[model samples]
Target chain A: MKGFKYLRNVTTLKMDSGKCINCSKCIEVCPHHVFALNGDKVTIINLDSCMECGACAKNCPAAALHVDSGVGCAAGLITEWLRDHRLLAKVECC
Target chain B: MPRISADLTFADRLGSWRVRWGIGRMNYIVPPGLYAVGRPNSDSPVLVTANYKKSYDSVRSVLAERDCWILVLETYGINVWCAAGKGTFGTEELIRRIGASELTKVVSHRQLVLPVLGAAGVAAHKVKKETGFNIRYAAIRAKDIPQYLDSGMRTAPAMREITFTTWERVVLIPMEFVEALKPTAIAAALLFFITAMLQDRNAGFLAVCGYVGAVAAGAAGTPLLLPWLPGRSFAFKGVLTGSIWSIIFYMLAGGSGWSRFMALAAFMILPAVSAFYALNFTGCTPFTSRSGVKKEMKVALPAMACALLAGIAIAITGMAI
Candidate 1:
């Protein structure tokens, strides 16, 4: 997190500002520090740092945060795609 | 809460080592229930954690001198972070564990200090509303627990933060290597047998070495030199390493006698194989996201397949000539 950064603008993380109650649960839970309290509402400050771990979204009481959270690794995604397309022998995601 | 010893014996250390090495890791679990960290009573603060032995050990070892209650949820030996993502360490499990343990009758406080990383599954408000135990995410690391409790249960920014230091990255490598062992062996054996039939025994041996080198460069080397590698996409960095390995092999293995086509094939195939393995290593990492991995595979996987196929074709043609 300090010295390394992943790809930019690829995360599907979104925040519903209107639904935010500024409880700061998202801020407290996020390991990446993706959220910030902007007055009475929470905002995605470090949007690119989001790893889509779903911590913030899951803990959000107001349901203001959303992200397509899963095993964000190439092997898992490849296995899923291949299975869906029937391209390879059924292999489980590790 | 039942009083239990917090001391980690030699056997626990050996067991943890075995688990880290992927031996009996899946079944290496502790019974999920409320246990004492030190001499804890009903007044002691409660800490929630997964039932993975490693996770339980990590929590208890940090609270050696302190008295606390640890609520371990049944996560089927998975660590807190992954188990949280899988929902085994979710709201339902927490609530069920609290109820099953009769935690309300044991503890006077309504708060349950959960690991910050576990927030992905447990909804604090829902847990509070349903079970009357207000979930408080204490800190990202268990080592910071004492300070967190001393600071009146308030988590400082640094405590909540996550950092993937070099040492942290290095520690995760062993499991990755262990997981990849079977696949690597099978691939190497296949390469050896196929190349022996296609060429000579010495050629088969050389081909096997080349393939193993590629795997090491991608699965092992790439992670060690991750920060310094030149590309955001792991596949690209792996390709660079693979190309370097191929060139080194060419010099060491005497590729000068081969046709230009054969040398080209070696460089292409080695790098592509390395790149594919490196890309797969994304699953072992902390930062790579679903969308990013998908985008990378879309471009890299096809390129790897094409390079591998073309390299084989060129190698065959050069041999015929």
Candidate 2:
């Protein structure tokens, strides 16, 4: 994390602190340590560290977190686009 | 229950090496089912993992001198993290696997220890509700498994954090190298003949080597020097490496002999190639997010395409004269 940092202000991750049940479920699931408990609610500690893998959002019982999760590979995105456009005969992520 | 050997055999080692270089990589999978690693009783720990041989191998090899039940989930040969993201390693699969394997009968405890990376696909509460198995995310990497088990299954902070060390980057280089091999070869072949006909044999060979170097810089160099490389965007990092490659190429190829326009062409085209390779590496890295990569591609891809086309157009126009 010290060396590997991706584009800042690009992640779609959003946190609704008011809706947080203080379960700390997001904190436990987030691999990037993107969330922290500020008082009785969950807060985004480091938004840049959020890879938007969607573990927190999926695991959150209160539905307080949101992020459009998907594979973040250029090649994978291109393949997705091609598949959407019907350009590729077979769409493969790898 | 099938008993698995924690110690890897020569064939297993060879298979791993082959897959690391992208040989039979897609099909490199173990059968999806429950297996006993070491003599295990009902009270032994149950660790869940993907059916990908690499994932399975990493987990088991670290578990030597320990007794456990490994519950292998079918992930179509993809690694746990990737499979989880794609939903092949999701709740449905986990629940189904548990039922199919008769997990309840085999193990007295209703706990399933899973790798933390696989958390993306699995919902812990849901799994617990559906199958009555308490999901325990033990560690991010297999190397940390021993510590987790020995220390009363406690997940230390370091066990959860992902580290992309130099050796980790080095190992991934081969796959990137192999992935870029075909395209690089074709482009180099075409560049060699075109440059030879347009400029001279000497310049053609130099151009080909330069192009190859750009690919290496993007695929290998950028990753190795990732932290040291400037810029957050993978494309930007690649461009820096490619620019360096271009400069080094000019010096090595004797820029004095090549025409000024041809030199310009190499500078434009080679770096773009490097950027492309570097951009492709987002798939290999752990920290890169889908949203961030999408934003980067919107700008980087068009710029690279334009650079490539302009460099080719300039070379042709200059060569005609």
Candidate 3:
């Protein structure tokens, strides 16, 4: 992770302050430390660092957050899409 | 608590069987619509997700104790980032789902919580314009959903980092080894045959060992030593390890009388092969970007090719003379 820097900003995460209960559930689930607490509310201080794993939205009780989290690897996605289209033989890499 | 349907069990069984047999992991497509989980109240928070079964299940399974509404969108059985890349998981889908589900009729609140990875697919501003529900991008993993809700929807820094731990690295080795085995076996067999024909039977066995060892060093050892390897690039790291292996093989296999040319050939070729296979690992790792992989391949490929060719040339000359 130190030497490798990702080119794709593949995270679909965004937060609405109006609905945020400031429960900080996003902080606990995320492996990347993408979010930080700003007083009683949550902040996406490092939005670009997200890998879109979808741990936060599923855990939020307030239902005040949204993200299109999923696998971010290009090769994995291409293989998945190809299988969906029936162009390539079925292969599960994950 | 709302009971999980029998259909879910059937689906889980099928998913696991498929995975075991190396079949494509089936993603169940949920229609882009809102549905209640555990008989939630109208005021319950709305959680958003792609229609991929794995993503849906991960969210639902984690939310078993809570009551909420799940807004699933058609991602064509693909996960969020990939679906987003293809535009299948986008603002348009979210808006359509919101309208079709009559979400306004179900919930009084205007906010929709979404997975962070879906940002590449869904445009928050467009979703707001087309549908009144404001998008809130949440944490990256499903396990943290409960904590997120309790924290008033706040995210901490730990929730965002992506880790590739030793166990994670170890789990990936099986598939890589399986994939590489066919080619490695073929290469080893060919080397064995050639060496046996040109030299002695013992030489043939040693050659086979060298080839197999190089493959292991490159494909398996390199990945396992990823964090500790000296060089930043995978290829360099692999070559470093392979060279050490080559030296060990040389001392054990009686290369002392060997000419400088042959010894040079051994050093050059074995490590290059190892490095090439190790460099291929960029596709497997989480940290590598497409651009970075391309950059590494551009420089590493030609050098590997040259070294391999030079080694072959030296070996042939040594045998001829």
Candidate 4:
């Protein structure tokens, strides 16, 4: 996660300090280390580093983190689109 | 409880190799329950992992001679990280597994050691609240599990960091290659026959081989040289890789005999082919995000389609000439 940088400004990661319980769950769960404790609440220190894995949001107790998390997989997207169009009979994804 | 050895048998190695190439990958599972690694007693540390045989095997192999209680959860054969992302390895399941396995009876301590990647699904606080078990998000890799346990269950910074080294990339290549092989063969056979019937058999054979090389460029080359490849977008990197392959193919198969149209077609078709496969690799990567891949596909997909179409159109023209 240190050197592998992806496209910039694409991730939908947002943090609400007002809603944050200062639980540090975001810091703990984030593999990319995107969140950091600023005083009490966590801040998105490296927004560009976010993979939007949603680990932080999923683990957050106070509902303070937000990100559109899903598999960043082209095959998964194609499968979903096919299913939406009813072209695929069964949906399989990772 | 099944007392499983920490050491893997020759059969385990063979199974691992088979799965790496996408054989029996879906059903590669161990039973979802409790197992003892190295004869773990009740007081030994409890480590949780998905029931995916690969995941289970990784943990056990790393443990070697170490004593630990392995709680294999039913993730339907998915590895820890992906299963965690899908919520199959979520807090609910962990709590359920603990209760059902009568884990407290098996382990005197209430501590559950989980792979750091599993943090995506399991909430430490929720598990503690429900099951009264303290969840320690341990090492991301099984290799680091021993050190983590040795360090009194505290995760070191290195243990938490995610790295996509060349070896890591190498191990993932087999499945991706195999996934593309069948479809590619079918498409290539059709194209090869058509081209042979239409113009020259030599051209057909060369073109099919070149196309397969392009696929290899995307699926195998891009990932192996990923860190050094140009562009952050995988599709772009793949195009570059394909371009390299196209050059190599052209030089090897004697491009002197090729018409200008054929030469042009190689660049266009090969790069486009590579770009599509490279784009598909987003799912296999450690750092790529859902949004980033979506954005990349939005821009790259149309371009690849156009390049492929144009290349085919001109190839037909070149062949007719």
Fnat per candidate, as a fraction, reads 0.83, 0.74, 0.17, 0.79
Which whole-number lDDT from 0 to 100 does residue B297 have in model 4?
Answer: 88
Which has the higher lDDT value, candidate number 1 or candidate number 2? Answer: 2
lDDT scores of the candidates, listed in order:
0.87, 0.89, 0.71, 0.89
User: RMSDs, each prediction?
Assistant: 1.7, 1.4, 7.9, 1.4
Which ranges in model 2 have alpha carbons more than 4 Å from their true place? none
Chain B structural similarity (TM-score) per candidate: 0.96, 0.97, 0.78, 0.97
TM-score of 4: 0.97
Candidate 4: the clashing residue pairs are: none
Q: Candidate 1 residues B36-155, lDDT tens each?
A: 877777789999999999999999988878899999999989999889888999999999998999999988879899999899889999999999888899998999998999999988
List, residue by residue over B1-321, the lDDT tens digit for candidate 3: 223431357767677445433356444555566767776777899988877777777788778668888888888787765676566777788888888888898889898887765655666656776777877776667777888888998765545455677776776666667667889889888888887888778777877888788887887888788888875567787798789789988998888977777788889989998897787776667555444444466677789889999998988788778
Please tell me which model should have the higher TM-score, number 3 or number 4: 4
Sorting all predicted structures by lDDT, with the top scorer first, yields: 2, 4, 1, 3
Interface RMSD of each: 1.1, 1.0, 7.5, 1.2
lDDT by residue (B1-321, candidate 2, tens digit) is 689889989999999999999999999999999999988999999999999999999999998888999999999999999998998888899999999999999989899998888988998889999999988888899999999999998989888888899999899999998888898899989989988987789778887888899999999999999999978999999999999999988887787677777788889999999999999998888899998899999999999999999999888887887
Instruction: State the local distance difference test value for candidate 2.
Output: 0.89
Model 4 CA deviation exceeding 4 Å by range = none
lDDT value, residue B248 of candidate 1: 92
Q: Name the weakest run of 10 consecutive residues (lDDT summed) in model 2 chain B.
A: B252-261
Alpha-carbon runs more than 4 Å astray in model 1 = A86-91
lDDT string for model 1 (A1-94, tens) is 6766778989999888888888998888988888887777678889888889998888888998889999777778877777889898867644
Q: What is the lDDT, from 0 to 100, of the residue A10 in candidate 2?
A: 88
lDDT of 4 at B181: 84
Candidate 3's C-alpha runs over 4 A off are A1-94, B1-21, B26-36, B51-53, B99-102, B181-209, B244-263
